[model samples]
Target chain A: MSAVGGGFGRCDAPRATARLEALTPFDRAGRRATESHASSRQLAGRTATITQDTSANPGDLFYLDLHTHSTDGSDDAGATVEGYLRWITGRRRFGYRIDGFVLTEHRRFDADRDYTALAEQYGVTVLRGIEVETDVGHVLVYGVAPGFYRDFDVTNVSLPYEDVFRAAREHGGIAVGAHAGRPRIGLAEHVDRRSVSVEGVGIVEALNGGSSDEENSHALHFAEEHGLKAVGGSDSHFVSGIARCLTAFPEPVHSVEALVEALLSHEYRPVAVEETHDDEEIRERSRRLQAVRSTAEAVHHEGGEVEYDHSVIGVEVEIGSAEITHEQIAAYCESTGDTNPLYRDEAAAEAGPFGGLVAPPGLLSALVQGRGPDPKVQYGNTTFMSGQRMEYVAPVRPGDTITGYASVKEVYEKTGRSGRMVFVVNRTRYANQRGEDVSANESSMVHRQVAPRKES
Target chain B: MSDAITQRYFEDVWPGDEYIEEHQPTGDDVAEYLHINQMGRRAQTGNLDGRFTDVAGAARQGLARPIVPGAMSMALITRLVTDWMGPLGHLRSIEVSFRRPVQHDDRLRANALVTDASDEDGEPTATLDVFFENERGERPVQGTAVVVLPRRTQPAPVVE
Candidate 1:
């Protein structure tokens, strides 16, 4: 609710919500009213009907990123629901008021995977929607209901756009053409060349974060000429890109039902997140990333010979031992956010095949000693753990005394794109009090030679 | 109590099956993990390169915050596999490659895709491709895991 300029102002919430329902759809009366609005809104000459009243109350305009993807549902999306929330919270510090974002995952909707708890924790309203491929282009469907899926196979890559548009309205949702100016998929190209006209299609994404300025311009003009209403979305597959463009509504939207109702009100507009003067946070993040990368790069510098004690390659020695306890097992689960009942719930464990609470396979790192006999490899200026392989022979339970025996498995040199590097492989075996081997681990470390300095 | 303790039989699984679980590590969680692994001593010894303990240390290394240890990242993936396999399945082997640093407070999703499931050499086993994907959609940690599970019908016990 922060000010972007003198243009936005907060109004009484109860009055705005009441007025919005009168202007939207829900019950019999609202639907009848909306049918008229929907029909008039669809006309290609309804441009003059759009309200440009400066006297309209701003209310609490909810700014929501209408399109986003997440790894939980979208295969190509890199952002998580929580990641977006955290980034949004960070943005709020800079006075950018991003109320929420919709998860418009590609091709599917997991109705059971709810984000209510996460939304409450972050104080951000989370809603679910879907983006499906069609003959015309990709379409963003908000407020998807179960009945909609029954009518259309949304997973179909080549769904008929005409049916999708009608079906969305029938199911209490809205379908907006996504990235409307992009090539091949956008509605603009189809309308211009193929004379493709989608009846009942009303809204198109006018400001997509992923779309180029020229592409967005094309979509804006397309909407103007077609007399289509518009919404905005980030179309963001990543965290930072979220809310770059969003739909600003006149009333607060807390659910899919409210979102649909508000869109039908035709009082919302696409708005970009205005940049603030105190955006040092974003700059600092990139700076840190650069630092981490450069530090890593310096370790991969070229030109050095590998040296190590050859005799210690196969020498085995006892490293250390620790008694596994139930308390330790519980603490490990808590630290890792592991909610597996078999590890924490004794009653559940007793009913299972194990017949008792067993430590997680990962707990071996804590039980087994970290340091083993050094391979004494003298090579590079940088050393790091490259990889680890572990084999569990048996389950380790509480009251088991675990002991680790270690040895230098091997030391070898390899050349990669980076340069010459020496790798030391260390092997460790964990045993119970009865001296039975429970697991074995092989960890490899890489030593990279320092790069030769440049002549300045 | 978690609802993930259900039993999974060897015969019920298939190749190409995928399981995803999310884990968000707080700064305290990372600190405790390093402490439990006895790596906290590095913090006391002034060896902090801003890797996994504090913010000031992270800033010195050009990091916005402390990072989760690679070992902890591996542990999270292990939990993902175990949670999916349930109590009946036994984890036989896991090999992981630490591809990138996972910063503290980063939300991660562990993904496991079953590559092969078969009864080989009288033992039923499943091979899975597992990875830890950060919010940035990058697989910072990934590898393969082999698990052993009990068949629904046991073969006749050795009569020797």
Candidate 2:
């Protein structure tokens, strides 16, 4: 309560005098009596009263990290549930307060298997959720029961998108279209007149970490066109990745219920990417390379004809010479809500046939950008992300600042119901600090040029 | 008159009615309502002192100033009917739609009119029209209710 009190202050001389003059003796007496009541009673009454306040106040602002992962699932640096909780609560202990966090693992893991139990053990409010990687797009379903994910078969269930969206809503959670415009099987490909007909969904991710300028812009345009609340995330995989794109509201989020209400009411604003970091240039260049690499990768994988230096290119390319440290991988996994220990569990990785820690396929793409893109230019887009098609040619261990270089292998154009689209093929070569090609990625993206109609 | 009665019901009643119950909502009520309902605070939590100051200002604007939840009004209507009809009577149906914004510090009344009564399976069923209006003669919620009443000879259950 530094300069910010519990949203109250003593009136200045004139206002105080006016208020005193306006009060009758009975009113003054009653006020005194009320003030003289016990402190506990006052606190209880205040708590009850604040619940009904409909106007913005300084005390009403609350913060939550809706997406987080542990090392219990796939594609992570092997940080345990407790380790993740310690990292998060440690921030609060050091004075950065967060209301709560949603543990959203990928489709392969169940939140209840380890995360929820550990959260309960730590006395933290953790919502059980899943970040489903559909063939068409990525969707984050929050506040859902543990068994719900199982009901929707990750492999075989061709459940209508509406059914999945409705199920998430019925269980007292929200279904957000995550990273809508990224190169893979994104929401733009899955969503149409049929998908839009599903009601009760009002949120969309307008920004994601590692997103390209074009992809982000597409996301923003989509959110605006559909009249939805735009959300943003770092899609971080590490502790440093927290707050990449924070949602700010007025404060004192007393419970998870209030937090949900805040989101549903659209009483929040997405913290732009540019506003997130201190270093502008580092983020900007990193973002550009991310776009270029992802674009080029998409082209080669889509079977498009791209004649480039494939012999010189390795399986994966590290953009800048940053060590592929164990710490970096672990942090990346945590921030992005990945919980698989194969990356973090050195013992497990060695015991397995791979004989060493292997990075998740998605991590291959994410790690290429390293820290994140320039935050300023990062604003304005709603994000829709898809799973990556990564091949682990070799083991990537700790203390490896893998240098990655990517080339646009080819470019093509196609026409769909959406409109004219351009596809870019990207091939990336990865090497250790020694500059040896360790892994490679061939990815493709189909960019739609036509802008979506704005909805009022 | 019967048509009006048919259109409204006792169970569907709220506060702020014109011909039945009359009372003026105050600044304190508005503040209490907002605080309890968690409606307008932009911040995550509520502020007690701010509520006190703002609620008073809202009252001066002639609105319900601190309009309580419609559920609260429904509860009050239920209490009123329960008291008049006795404990053996069961509230069967209640339907209400908020027509206009109800603000803080507005004088309000709750009203009801019995329109239909019939005997079915030895039980008496009554239909009543209900309404809620402010001192300014505006209806905020209006609807109807159906209730099943026990025989007059049967004593209502007593709890010690």
Candidate 3:
């Protein structure tokens, strides 16, 4: 059983010593884990504890879970907005202090009716925002009004992609690509030359609640290549899920204005829980991969450049009809920390001009596309997602078994600031259970040659 | 009724004085807690990579340093007060908030105070304030509580 104590400095003698003795082993193990994951300890290295007194000071560092959701917008059945507020306020019988939280719901819902009053009541800073799921990818628009783009039809609108980007910028909002990589949901199509030249987006999601290390690495590479600010989020729908992933800013930001300024200034780093691994063990596994035969075949070869038109590269598969549940959408949003109401609340969606519940554009991107039971791709080499360019055609309603098909369009090599990199482009088309095209996304990937000495 | 103490009764009193208790949280404790709660089980089940680093990375970023759940702190405080006041002590209220991030290797000390005690409607109740601090003397958790304790039984003086 764990021991107990008083409010502040009640017990200073035996209790203090006993506490130290009990903590020694845990402290040692934590140190070892921190040491093992040294290379990826960017956020851990910058950790500075914030106290209530220190938070009053302007320069004190604070960690903010920039992306969060609540039951008010999304279909988070387990937690209410009040529960979330109390959980973070450290005022409940069992609570914890969160510097602040941004109330980002889907554009389909009203933030004022659902979250604003609660924020005021709780005395916690709430940044009004939305996670716009566009054709290209999910973009987090912070510091915007609750209904800023309520009338905009993200899927069918003919406005240029830049117009939407500018809309966020005009609203003093930061546009961040949500989950740049993680197989189904990332924006791997936006990095194409045509898309990059046209969109000019500025932030990338480096850590997502639902992504793995490999997915995070893809996001990291995108941030590095595009010179964009990196952000992280738990994408929580359940109250307990908040703060899973956070951005530790160099200073405290207690308001929407300050949050926007922090993002604009690039003053934060992504921090998650640390992992433990031994060097030699990982090295041994890499050594084993060296024995696998290369499946390289050249369709065209020229001056130090070989183009492989591998016959098996463009395999097309159909994804059959499947039900779209609110739980699935909520889970996806929670994983990404997007709380857009169009995906969560049925009444709000019905009351909307669209007159129905609509999936967040991000969820559309996340849903698997491919026909048949065996549609998995065995990708060789690093799958570095460059960007996404999406065009939403229709609203994907619940109980719709969306059909999807994917085909590889091109593969090529280019030399950039990071030396020679290979780019592979894939196009995916989505249709409703009725066999109508609802959206299409073109995804791009870049594989860099890992120098032998620098291999992970 | 004054001499009878039940678990429910023990949870009902609130004290006014301050007190503290310290605890040590272990890695196994963390592992068990997460396993039971399934906080980040989805990521763990999806990623089959054998490296503990991968598991920890996913769990940490997904659930705040992969330590015990914050709710567990409340459960501990309830147990402490109940054990001290015996079965007749009833916990009336408990309010705790996390002050600092609690990691795997940190030792936690819970301090509490019984500030008020009185007889109401033939029952004795106490109000208390409490909090939990880490090894560095940082308050990772804080709250106020109230409990009702049983009084000693007395013979009828008039009849004697």
The DockQ figures for the candidates are: 0.12, 0.01, 0.02
* lDDT for each candidate structure: 0.65, 0.43, 0.46
* Tens-digit lDDT string for candidate 2 (B1-160): 1111112222322111112334344555533434333322222234332312344532342222335444334433432343333323445544333334455455555554343445645646664445455653344544445556554455322211
TM-score on B-chain, cand. 3: 0.64
Q: Enumerate residue pairs that collide in model 1.
A: A288-B62, B50-B57
Give the winner by TM-score. Answer: 1
Tens-digit lDDT string for candidate 3 (A1-456): 222332111222111111122322322112110011101111111111111122222224465676776656642212356655654542112212345566565433364464557778887666656665554445666766534465355322122345566776776666676666433234543453224442457776677654444456566666666677787775554444455456767777877778878888866776442211112221122110011111211111111443555563667655434456776666654433233344567775565434666554444544553322222223223333443445556667777777667777666543322233456766778888777887776655555442222112
Residue lDDT tens for model 3, B1-160: 1111122232232321223334565655454433332332332343422111233442433223434444344445543454344432334444444333466656665555443445755656664545555654344554445555654453211100
- In order of lDDT, best first, we have 1, 3, 2
- Ranking by TM-score, best first? 1, 3, 2
- After superposing candidate 2 on the true structure, give the runs of residues whose Cα lies further than 4 Å from its correct spot: A1-60, A76-78, A89-97, A108-111, A114-125, A155-159, A189-200, A249-260, A272-456, B1-160
**lDDT for position A42 in model 2:** 10
Off by over 4 Å in 1: A1-300, A415-420, A449-456, B39-50, B55-65, B151-160
Candidate 2's displacement at residue B17, Å, is: 67
* Estimated TM-score for each candidate: 0.48, 0.35, 0.38
